[model samples]
Target: MALSWDDEPTTAAPAAAAGNPEASAADVAKRVNADDKRIINAKTDVNQLVPFKYKWAWDKYLAGCANHWMPQEVNMQRDIELWKNPNGLTED
Candidate 1:
């Protein structure tokens, strides 16, 4: 696209903010604590489930997501071979 003014779409300047442009640490804390919905919503970033809703389940889910690995790295080939011949498997 050309960098000419005629080629660019025009956008109006945003309306003036009503409150302080800078959000204090306390302000963030208040918003996070004021409503549980904000922190525990379907639009959670990184899909980091809310620990409040499911407690331990949420923690386990986050731990699983944090993991970055492939199934082959864990060596599941033996299990697949065994499954193909259950009769040859032993209790051990």
Candidate 2:
């Protein structure tokens, strides 16, 4: 009846799991925690904006989209003509 350093415990942590197993299970079964979120391919709802885990990242993405240059703003007629006739442009 002596225990060694490599011996495995035959019992659980008494104080932590004493009589609140139901409470602990409830806590675990709650909504997806922020720590469990990921940048891509997350198990939680990706479209959920209210309880966002990375608020700063979402804001940055919105800012970038707002400040982006749209293709409609540029007149591509000249470029298209030049593309059809590549003789005027240099090879480089």
Candidate 3:
């Protein structure tokens, strides 16, 4: 199926606004230390070491949202272009 760049996904609330700060911090700590969260396979280890593959997939899924589609630096450039011209369509 063809993709539609005009349909951008909405960004969720910031972490601070999503929940209580203290609770969110505690949850983050818990997840970081949880043994069950440790890698169980080489695939997981590789993914952690090289995240670009996953990032590319995510970017493709969130196409029109340039913030998510590109890296931080590239996003900044794209943001400026997008601001000047709001249409999300890309040549790709």
Which candidate leads in TM-score?
A: 2
**Of 1 and 2, the candidate ranking higher by lDDT:** 2
List model 2 lDDT by residue over 1-92, tens digit each.
Answer: 33355777576334436488887787668687453444443455555665546989888878877898888988899988888885957778
lDDT of each: 0.59, 0.67, 0.54
- lDDT tens digits, residues 6-92, model 3? 666667445655658886776667534333344543234332533456877767656645545435444487667776885765676
Poorly placed runs, candidate 3 (over 4 Å) = 1-31, 46-92
Residue pairs in collision within model 1: none
The local distance difference test score of model 1 is 0.59
Write down the lDDT that model 2 would get. 0.67
Report lDDT (Cα) of residue 86, candidate 3. 50
Residue 70 Cα positional deviation in candidate 2, in Å, after optimal superposition: 4.1
After best superposition, candidate 2 residue 15: deviation in angstroms? 42
